[model samples]
Target: MPLHDFRSDTVTLPSPAMMAAIAAARLGDAARGDDPTVADLERCAREITGKDDALFVPSGTMANLAALLAHDCRGGEVIVEEAAHLYNSEGGGLSVVAGAVARPVKGRHGILAPASIEAAIRGSANPAVAPTRLVCLENTHNAAGGTVMPVETMAAIHDVARRAGIPVHLDGARLFNAAAHLEVPIGALCRPVDSLWFALCKGLGGPVGAILAGDAAFMRKARRAVRMLGGGMRQAGLIAAPALVALDDPYPAHRRDHALARRLACGLAAIDARLVDADRVQTNIVNCHVDDADDIARDLGARDVLTLSRGKNRIRFVTHSQVDEASVDAAVDALADILATRPNWSTPCRESLPT
Candidate 1:
């Protein structure tokens, strides 16, 4: 049997159609703005995001870094949720590359409260403190088991930022998942923020690239930032071609991935309800709590099942285009068997479960 890889959506390989599009791509020097395929991809991205302009970059990290650099000057502060990927997963690029400071605020399941956001904003006449430059939000927040932030919640945060004269940037790496879950157009979600980015390589199933979208002037600033960061490319349509196809209509794939994730979460709950809160499995990522995450991951790997250890006692499983319902079922069965055979395995008390 083939390995059941549930580590992340980034592991998904491009489909054959995507490969064909890549091969037939029309390429030119992207640095000079002549790559037709790249232009087409950016146009599609802009249309989908309801932004005035969009720029394709090498990775989600770079897209976010460009947005940060464009929105804030050196020594400026960026507000983010404590569990956001920007604060925890992006390798400090916001500070190291963009020369910005991160001010983290605790959020509930990755959604920042409007009051907390307002409180974190700094507007005093003191020069000692860094002025708040931007507010960053993650939709379908990765660290919080892919929880989707409601439109109302995002609007509230945006309103607070607007009143404080702070720009809002959305790290929407999995924005499609959030849109699918909410049954809303991606543009509806994008409207609240000043700028946002989404990954084509994640649930969209493109082999490479991400898009940063906003107004024309902001994108021009982001383009310069991309070049400054050594993110420019020549004949980049090889990657952009596939990304165009992925962006054309991603809802079907996103819907399937979300369904598979829920199925997997439900199955895991049946085996041991303490393992995961099925109600919290809102998108494509399922985070399960175990007594020993590393031990469980290693054991699952031995069975040709792969999952990522999030911490001391949490494992993450991400469903994508490459994983089907059958594969999800197989993974759930393997995990159920493993837990059943462990002599010391016991359901934890509800009060003791991690939130």
Candidate 2:
């Protein structure tokens, strides 16, 4: 029996073509600037993001952390959305590892308020306050059911940050998703920030890696920070080759996933389960509320369905390139069955942070 894996896109395996690319990759000493494949990937990413340079990192977390470290050089603070990956996920690496503070502002879903951003920046003005040096925004924000923050909002934040002389960094892990969902070019989605990073592993279908693109000078600094974090790779072309393949063959998993999410949302809504706003299903993620996620996840897992129980009862169902239309619909039907038969199911509850 096959397990319907709605756990996350990270579970996606590389395609046969990607494997061939990886196997045929030519290797060189990356530390000494001899890896031609990694070099090409970096160059390609720069061109894709319309940036002066790009640095290939082992993971999105490293790329984001390095970008932040480069942005807030003088032990400065970073303004970000309250539920951003940098704040909620990443294990507090920004504060503990990089010696930078994250000043989280209230935002709807993963969307940050420009007014809230302005207030946060102004609020950090006391003598003891850490200098606000950077603003980070996530598009197709993962925590917000993969919501797409519009380009105008991005422009407004960019304008505010520019006037304050603060650099803005975008944690564009699922940027391609944002671009596809908005029907905009990836470069247009990236025009608002000083630095941006995108992931190759998730949805892009690469086996491993992420890329951080920025101006030439900032990239030079980011390289040093990369070394500081021991991310300086050797023979990284092995990973870069596959990333090149994934990027070249763009797919509509973003839209398909969004549709799957809507199906899941409507299915659960029919059963009256505590759920996220169906209208906000913009990309691939579907965050739903269940009062007993542990038991529910276990129940589904026993039936060969996997999901991420974010909290005690909050679950995140993610559709990927691997989950075909049939699987998506089956998972929705499975959930409906769960809610229908389970004695504790069928009630909406208050939204609370996953415990």
* Residue range 1-355, candidate 2, lDDT tens digits: 6778989999998889989998999889887789999999988888888999898899999998898778764577888888889888999898888788888887887788777777777435587878888899998788777888999999999888887888889999899888888888789977888999999988787889899999988999999999999998999999999999988846565667667777777766666635556666788888877778877787778777899887775788887878876676677677767766776554445557421
Worst 10 residues of 1 by lDDT: 346-355
Which ranges of candidate 2 are over 4 A from the true structure?
Answer: 123-125, 273-276, 343-348, 353-355
What is the C-alpha local distance difference test score of each model?
0.90, 0.82
Q: In candidate 2, residue 168 scores what lDDT? A: 89
Instruction: For candidate 1, write residues 1-355 as lDDT tens digits.
Output: 8888999999999899999999999999998999999999988888888899988899989988899989964688899988889878989998898899999998888888999999999974789999999999999899888999999999999999999988899999999999999999999999999999998899999999899999988888998999998899899999999988887778988999999999999999998887889999989999988888899999999988899997777889999988888889888889988997896776544433334
Roughly what TM-score does model 1 have, to 2 decimal places? 0.97
Error of 1 at 68 (Å): 1.2
After superposition, the stretches of candidate 1 with alpha carbons farther than 4 Å from their true spots are 346-354
